[model samples]
Target: MATYDPFRDLDRLASSFLDTRRGPRRMPMDLYRDGDHYVLTADLPGIDPGSVDIDVDGQLLTIRAERTLSAGDGVKWITREREAASFLRQLNLGQGIDTERISASYDNGVLSVTIPVSEKAKPRKIAVSTASDSQVVQAHESGADEPQPIEQ
Candidate 1:
């Protein structure tokens, strides 16, 4: 009791031809900003953790993983659909991202990357001085003998 889709098969065939030299395939990913850090998650199921590679060059982040299929001797294959393939994904981190503190982790067939925002890009509050402090600063700037009253 399985339904067949002709369009799905056709699309798969076309993709196989186009992706022959492009390695395994591009896995789906999600990128979102969480507070002061940006989080990126990618789906990479059935891939060995050791085979996963993450690299950051300039403002570009690259991720690669490989999936291998093994068969035992004298084993008869029936309905083999999963094939060995390499997965590659890249993302461009903009200027506000802190490249030095970028961290990545892989767990449960999912890869998560955390990118911190640069200190310079984060908003900061400026301290507002009292009226007396402003008056002192104004007196210092004017080089007056006594502290002058600050005009509103």
Candidate 2:
């Protein structure tokens, strides 16, 4: 014996209309820096890999995907919940990013993007010339956190 709640139906209807698959939806994602590259992973379940599109325009990175529900010959949906829709996400990559080498891959419904920092942007050691001679000290940029001796 299943009971139907009118309030639940009303709420569902309201959300469905507000959702309006015609409009773009947001994709859940996580971004973090790993070594010299940044990794961004996003969830895109029930979406075709072919429908996924990623592009970089100037400093902006854009992602778009579309999801569609297939209904075959005289098929009826008992309770249609998942709405067919489009997803869009964009981020301003800003400067110091090596946009030319940016790459992305989709696996198991997760979209992963690898963004590498420009060579000049990477932290490097600068050789400090000393008047006293033989030993070499290292000078790093202000934000490098440590100033250690250069290894041979």
Candidate 3:
């Protein structure tokens, strides 16, 4: 009897199956955080900017695009293939998200989104005092007479 490793077989099977499924493959995206903002970038070529819509409903961010094409009326036989597809991507943003400050822009087949963190989530710099005017006072113990003014 032999034990099976799910990961070993899972990768091989999933890769082959996904490879066979063609037509407008789901694009890959990169997410990174800098300072107090998080950025999400995705590649969506051959898609019109007018047809793309980005929205954040609750904590989920969704992007959808629709495309259409037309041919002449003189065609005898038709072999039509759909060039448009509804791509739904939902991201569950954890706590500390500033939903009101979310913004998105699409240009040159790329979509960029900047999500600002809540006010409390942003880092703040504390001011440090460097002046020598501040002084520290010491207290004397019960028996220790308030140290009389040092002898001149």
Tens digit per residue, CA lDDT, model 2, 94-142: 8899999999999999999999999999999999987676677797867
Candidate 1, residue 100: CA error in Å? Answer: 1.6
Best by TM-score: 2
The digit string of per-residue lDDT tens for model 3 on 37-97 reads: 9999888776778877888888888777755566568876554434455554668888889
TM-score of each: 0.73, 0.77, 0.59
Clashing pairs in 1: 24-86
Better candidate by lDDT, 1 or 2:
2
The alpha-carbon lDDT assigned to residue 10 of candidate 2 equals: 91
For candidate 1, write residues 1-152 as lDDT tens digits.
98988999899878866755644689899999899999999999999999999999999999999999998999998767677889999888879889999998999999999999999999899999876664323444466677765455
Stretches of model 1 off by over 4 angstroms after superposition: 1-22, 127-133, 137-152
Stretch of 10 with least lDDT, candidate 1: 133-142
Which one wins by lDDT: 1 or 3? Answer: 1
Which parts of model 2 are misplaced by more than 4 Å? 1-10, 17-21, 134-152
Residue 72 lDDT in candidate 2: 88
Each model's C-alpha lDDT? 0.87, 0.92, 0.76
